[model samples]
Target: MNLVLFDLDNTLLAGDSDYEWGQFLIAKGAVDGPHYEAKNKAFYEDYKTGRLDIYAFLAFALHPLATHTRAQLDAWHAEYMETHVKPMITQTARDLVNKRLDDADLVAIITATNSFVTAPIAREFGIPYLIATDPEEIDGRFTGEVAGTPCFREGKVARLERFLEAHGTHLDRLGSSWFYSDSHNDLPLLEKVQHPIAVDPDTVLHAHALAKNWPVISLRGDQHA
Candidate 1:
């Protein structure tokens, strides 16, 4: 089956999941103060502007809970999905995903967001595969460090490569592998796909898409990459 990879966040959701997730933590009492929100918001800007590296940005975002146990983080993630991110999935995107599945496409989510956060979103959508940055754990506690490469920018392509290897699939073998993304940060993956579609593209990606004759579509113009 052909692979249909999708970026999370703005491509799938209307807003930044990371910032909202941090807000969830603060609201749930899992984290304290307004610093979490500030840090996450700033990280979004830095990431979009290509200022912050993926690993460092994630570490900074989660630093407040560095001392929390893995179990605690897991519970928090579960709650965050149910109470925060789960309800934010746009109906248009949901319809799109359903249509792709109906076509028997091999669906997967490739995001820079942490696996702990993206797992539930993927599960809710019934997606069987997800490739995201995994946080390190030791002694049943979070180490505040990434276990592997932070799946951002070109890292998304690297993770997809590993996924293909594990599943005995390759890009060239697919009949019509497609990728949908929003941010300019995902340009690497967007460029690698056989069918690259810019969904809710950012300014940089929008211009490139137009200049290259790439498809630029939005789910009701709600995409703000």
Candidate 2:
């Protein structure tokens, strides 16, 4: 069976989940309004420019989990899924994923966002497998620290390799593989896949996709390259 991988944020959703999560927390007063919002925007800009420091961003992004109980976090996330994330789920994105699910034996959402934030999003897409950055947990509470290599840039390949090894399979074992993403940060995995699709890609990734003669699509509108 073929393998299909989808990037969670801008690729499948019309927006960035990590950035929106921080905005949600700020609106809820879980984080300082000005300070948190400023940093969130800065971090988002860094991500767009391919200059993000995953560890540093995690310290800021995961701080809410450390401050609140798991139950509280869960409740907030439920609201987040309902309010922020659900609206971003366009019919086009759903159709794309459903099509892939029907065609592939294994379908997964691979993202740099922490599991705490993305797990439910994956569920919403009906994707059974998720490869996301893990937040350190002690006694069922987050430490606001990353557990392993943050799944950004080259780290995505490392994490996926480890995941495949645990399943007693490798990239070559799959008859064919497809990876859909928007950011240049996902170039490592996109290049690794046999069918690399750029969905609503940013400027850098869009240019790279054109150079590589990869398929470029936009769920936001009727745009294709």
Best candidate per lDDT, number?
2
Instruction: Report the lDDT tens digits of candidate 2 across residue range 1-225.
Output: 588999989989889999999999999999999999999999999999989988899999888889999999999999999899988888888888899899888899999999999999999989999999999999999998889988888999998989878878899888999999999999989989899999989999999999999999977744321
lDDT of 2: 0.91
Task: Estimate the TM-score for candidate 2.
Answer: 0.96
Per-model RMSD to reference: 2.8, 2.5
| 115-168 per-residue lDDT for model 1 (tens digits) | 767888888887888998887767766677888888899888899988988888
**Which ten contiguous residues of candidate 1 have the minimum total lDDT?**
216-225
- Regions of candidate 2 where Cα sits further than 4 Å from its true position: 221-225
**What 10-residue stretch in candidate 2 is worst by lDDT?**
216-225
- Full-model lDDT for every candidate: 0.80, 0.91
Q: What shift in Å separates residue 100 of candidate 1 from its native position after superposition?
A: 1.1
